[model samples]
Target: MPPGPERFVGRERELRELRADIDTPSLDALRGRPAATCRVLLVAGRPGSGRTALALRLAREQAARYPEGLLYAALTDPQGEPRAAREVAAQLLRGLGREADDDPEAALREALRERRVLLVLDDAASGEQVAPLLPHGETALVVATSRGPLAGVADVRPCTLGGLQSAACVELLAQAIGSTRVTCDPRAAETLAERCGGSPAALRLMAGWLADRPGMSVTDAVRVLPDDDATPLERAFGVVAAQLPGPAARLMRMLVLAPGALVDAHLASALAGCALEAARDALEDFARYGLLRRDPGPGAGTEPAAYRVAGWAVPLLRDALEAGERAEEVRLARARMLERTVRLVRACAASAAAPDEAATDEVPLALRFADREAASGWLRRRLPELLGAARIAVADGELDTLARRLASAAVLALDAHGQAAPERYELHGLLLEVAERRGPDRERAAALINLGDLDAAAGRTKDAVARYRAALDAARAGRDAFTLGRALEALGDSHLELGDRERAADWYGRALAQRGERGELADAARLHTRLALLHTDDGRRDAALREWRAAAAAYRRLRDHAGYAATLAEVALAQEVSGAAEESLRTGQEALRWARQADDARLQRVVLLGMARVLERLGDTEGARLQREAADGLAGPGDARDS
Candidate 1:
């Protein structure tokens, strides 16, 4: 019987516990109970820990107890969705004698009562999800392998699995390559086993990998293991990547750059820089040969399975991603990934909703669940990768679309993670050189504009003004209206910082007129808000109020709450300056509400402080003190500049 297939790596304790549970008569009676009863056995372990191997071994070894048949199914939910319970039940029933058209759950329960089968559910995701398909019948046995705890099943025997012992790991490697070769260099074999953390899937992957590479010593393979202790799977991945063909090697690198390890044929083709047919063939070959793990994509319907380098292979995969490719290519690939990553981060950074894709070239990775916590977590984990890409792009003098896009991504990423001040001010400095080199005109202007904005935020008014002038000249030479508008607004803001209200108003007016003529409502709204502030500084309260109202209207049309609240706050300031005490109180209250609604605590504090000054001027000492206290409370702990 081939010993029902070697359980092949480790978890002796888990096997013993499972054996004990199976032998227990009370548990057996529950499983064998009349219709409407079921027993579920969950085998939980990390990826590559041999959960599936163990489950299969246990199921086959106990086959004599299940005289009816052995039924197996893989539950791979489509991307962006959970697998349908009904669909899983239907597949289970069809594996037996039931028809596909029959009510799945009902038919499943019926079939379970009819036979004593060994059911193996492979790659199960969770407990609640797999529990429904459990069978009732004394002679039947159910084995499920998953990444997490399964819930709510009677007489449940939970088997927690782990990697192999050193000896088993070495034996696995020996069986994979040659026992004599591995045994000859026990030290090298021990190193490989330790590097793989005794993971059977890892061991198997390494076996296949080493089998192909005659020149590579087991010690050489261990050297490339990912440095992170928590990700042993990736260390094994690095070993596998060093063994792939050119196309497969490139494919592995590109796949790691993808978000969530998911990619379709279209994306895979783009990544490989090849035709879809070739990409599909390569993907199939990879899966067939076990170089990659395949799972059906979310909402894939009947589409081909999406592939990822096995978890054990991630380290190898990332090493491949970082290796061989010229520094320039690696930088560009990272730039692309960050372009997508930053878009996602920016979308989540907002206190309100995401913007439309058509309005901007950068679009966010939309979340079906709208989970802020999850989005934030993804950004934090990938921060190093994104930062490395930005640094690489700036270092390589290849300032093309890729470089510019990378700079934008870097800026947004910094902002999203709240690292805009001192931590990322250096990024702005790096981008300046790339922009200056990449541009004959438009690129130069855009880069200068961004540099000016960064400088202004850092309180370098003089440097900001200089960069804005350079941007303005480049914008005029290139005849780029948007660039010119941005430069004009930036220059105007710099002037305002120097208390040059007249110059600020003039620049803001020009920007407002140009953006208005261009029908760029969003840009026009921003310019109008700046003009409102300049007018207020110039003591023209009525003009400031008018500009703010118009700005707010424009921002509202564009669904830009950040811009709207800023303009509204200016209007409140105008009311206060014009000595309209009652109106100032009402407008200030409204402005504060809008600022909070916009989810910008920094802007909210600024507005509250302004309101405090207004209340003091109007002789409401109590109200003034309360507003000041509230603003101070909000400004607690963090850098006052971060918000």
Candidate 2:
């Protein structure tokens, strides 16, 4: 369930309305049978208006009615990216003690059809995301909370929440401080509440400010608060921020300029140029003072908590960051953030590809990871922050080097993790703008290559080919051999996708020759794999097998288990096609072992399915059946095959 309302104040009427909707039987249920339609209750409100708290409270109240389960899913990351629907479905399936099957949505719908589940989807980006996750059964209810009305969703009971009532605001203040303190100055309490504009978040922050000073009277508190053109929430934030010591206050301002919504102590340390311990202390103090909110760490307290600037306080903080003397400070802080972010991303990419003993010495101690999984997890959590910081750097102009490096590192990390998304393309476009304006030739080449990759992924082959050609020109101008090779390879891929076999082969051959001359084994291996695919597509099985073998050898030398496993699977398939059943089965088993060692479930499933087909061809029916079952078990709810 979402966190309980902290000193939850008014909204009795809204609560009653929510209760009535949940308690009353649906029209279909009233007709003596349940219907295949979900009842959606949308609780919409402004930021800091307590929408999440109200929705969670309603979910808690109706928990008993949903005996099968109460499932809560946050539909967006802190940076406001809408999570993929398949990922959300997997979470729901896990909560229900079920593994994700191929077709997670169908699996979830089936489960909901047989059970009474109440889903509370918080911070949804749009109605489209909510629509796919809705339970199509009368026995289930969905309470969706968003900053907007979710306007286009059909059959929703929309409740748009505003600030608290005057009396409730005072009551909330009293609860935070004490009844005695508030009642001692009832009129002053009411005045303060009015000044806060009845926003529970603002009121609570003000209450914390007052509660910190034992002898500060309510009148005095109201007197010290800012009265300006800013909104009540902003003024309230200003009032609280004023009380913080210099370090805390400065950190608060810098945080507003921090990329994305949340920050860890390591990032804070980088921004502050202070020790990690000091940054952590300042962050904790901000949380205590109600200027920040602490998010629970990953699983079972293994990690330290992360902090986010309270939503209501952000505008005021940003205002402070941009005002007069703080502008330079904000710029410097963002530069530091960009440098550190670039290093972290590079470290993650290196760690994911292959561990480097010397690389550890180069990475900051705070950014070093235990293994690939840890590095990947950190990259996933901070992707939006890294992208946001890169944009800030690009716009700022002074940090062009850091910006270029950050963009390059981010692209590498995203590629390594197979997490390329449309947002990344947008970020690459921003990088391209920066490159065209003031970046070095090498940076310009890198940006063009990254943009080309995005265009190819989006199926804009012509656009990708154009970008790659531009990249090749930049690379040649800069005399950057590595980027030259990369651009050629990318161009080859674009032409391949466009069915221009001759052009594709010419580009691939040039890229391969360049990589081989440079002793860039990884790039050479990837090129060989691509060439093998082209060969196989053209029915040149012998040539394809030769290329796959070379690629596998290079991958093994690099200790790239995932790549080697994939190449081995292709080899197995080729062997099977050539009537070498025993050799095919042997290679398939070896591929499966490597996939397991790499902990890549997708690769494991691919190998298993391939093995199953080979086994079937070899007339081993029982073995084939077992392999197919194993493959099915490893398939995720969102597997492309299911789609």
Candidate 3:
């Protein structure tokens, strides 16, 4: 079982009842029946009612009894879409060390038939998804958690979880905020818990808020927690939000526009158009109020923490955003957010292309970082928020240019980080929608090309080809060589992935020519490298060498020592493969020298290993051994190779 909260303080009675139900055999099983055998326990609750947490805790406590194995699966994706039953079954099969057959459900059921396994199905959407995954044997136990009761399923024991008891709520608060704080004013603590409707989620948030303010007493908390006629959770969130300072309150409302679960101070600063320090302070303030929860920053050192609005607080904050005067504030905040996000994402792209030791002047002073690593870290941490801001920007209609730039920069950052999940495809679709609606042909072409790239990455070559063709048309309409070259190249790559080598070569040639005509040396160099790989795949060694040499020269001209070194390494490998061992040795040596200049240990290692193999081919056993040792030494601990 995964770890539960550090301080679990409630649900003893529910836990006892659950244990009793698990130990008690079903009436049908008692009659020695095989048809209605397996024991199924359904734990149902609302979104933030700690349903998953309690389920996990029970699983951990009872794990020892099930000797076969413990299997778990989330029946829904993070976006709350119901995950396909086949996918969930596949997960279970993998857990059981078995490959899923055509019918994953059947496979999983069969695997668990004779085993006393504990299977946990979390966040189940409907009975259909749960029914097929249930264990068929009497020995096995299945725990299915859902927001509502699985009324459609037969012969299942149901356990409905509600808010914590008052005592439990107070205990949870004390556990989170500290005993001294709660014990200092026991009556006030109980009042706070009862006012929060004894909901563990609400209590936890309130406790976290109080924890952040060491000087704040329980009485002070109760005094500030306003009275409201709304739902208990909503009223509790309102009371917390009402007590926050003006800037912090405004920031909380703006956070409703943030996409996804987490945001960093940089994003907050952008959204609020405030100083980074002020943005961070506001976030900390919200954390103190339990309106937000903090997570460790992306990288090491003193990086600002990431935060998410408390689950219960989100709807309330969103309500504030859409209601009355706050609506206009949301509009301006989103615009500022889009502007700042675009600039930061652009900086991320620039840093990835040419990592530098110092921040560039082009980056806003507030957004600048110490180096490329810091910039990239910021981008990685904030990609979801950036994508979210892009969606909001597109929806706003007037920020079309900002939306286009944000989409372009975000796509670049995603590519740089090699993130090719469903979210990337979704973002590209959003970008395409915005581009087609309000952007120029160039932006539309870029969006289309990005979509093509995503399709290619997912191995949908035909779809990618279609998108690239559409992109080419848009690029032609715009008469932009950069966009045209990219579309042509993507078309070539998609066809190549589909194994149409002839068409791939033809498209590559056109793109190369277009880039050359437009003096896009970097792009041309990249195309040359692609062509080189294509030729090599077709056993055209001499052609590959020619392309590699062209690529190396372009990198050298641009003073990109890293790219030059990498291209040189490829050139040397081609030389060795073509029986030019002596030339390969010298080229490999030159590659290593450039790798050193670029301070790329990974590149240096590659060059050394290549040289070692070439030396072995040249019958210099001692030289080969020396190079191998040097390469191995570079692989020692603390090398920290780039991804």
Each prediction's TM-score versus the true structure: 0.42, 0.66, 0.61
**Candidate 3 wrong stretches, greater than 4 Å:** 1-7, 16-43, 52-145, 150-158, 173-195, 204-229, 296-304, 343-385, 418-423, 481-643
User: Relative to the unseen true structure, what is the C-alpha lDDT of residue 341 in candidate 2, on a scale of 0 to 100?
Assistant: 71
lDDT of 3 by residue, 479-532 (tens): 977788888988888888888998999999999999888888899899999999
The lDDT leader among the candidates is 2
Kindly list the per-residue Cα lDDT of model 1 for residues 1-643, writing each as its tens digit: 1122222555677888888877566554546645344445778888668776677778877888888887766554322234556667765654463443335676686677757787877667666666677665555677777777766666667887666789888877777677777866789899878877877766666676676666766766566665576556665655566657788778767765544454545446656676667777777655533445554222121224456444434545565666767767765655555444444435545412344423233332222213434434444433433444565455556534554565566566556545433325445565666656655788778777877876786678999999899999989999998799888888787888898878888988988888999999988887777777667767777888898899989987987777777777777777777778678778778778878888888888888888888788878999888887788778857636222
Off by over 4 Å in 2: 1-5, 23-37, 59-142, 145-150, 162-171, 183-191, 194-197, 222-231, 272-275, 296-303, 324-326, 343-375, 412-433, 450-463, 480-497, 502-643
Report the error of model 2 at residue 248, Å.
2.9
lDDT of 2 by residue, 457-512 (tens): 66788998999999999999999998899899888988888889879988998999
Compared with the true structure, all predictions reach lDDT values of 0.65, 0.79, 0.77
Off by over 4 Å in 1: 1-7, 10-13, 27-36, 76-81, 242-245, 252-643
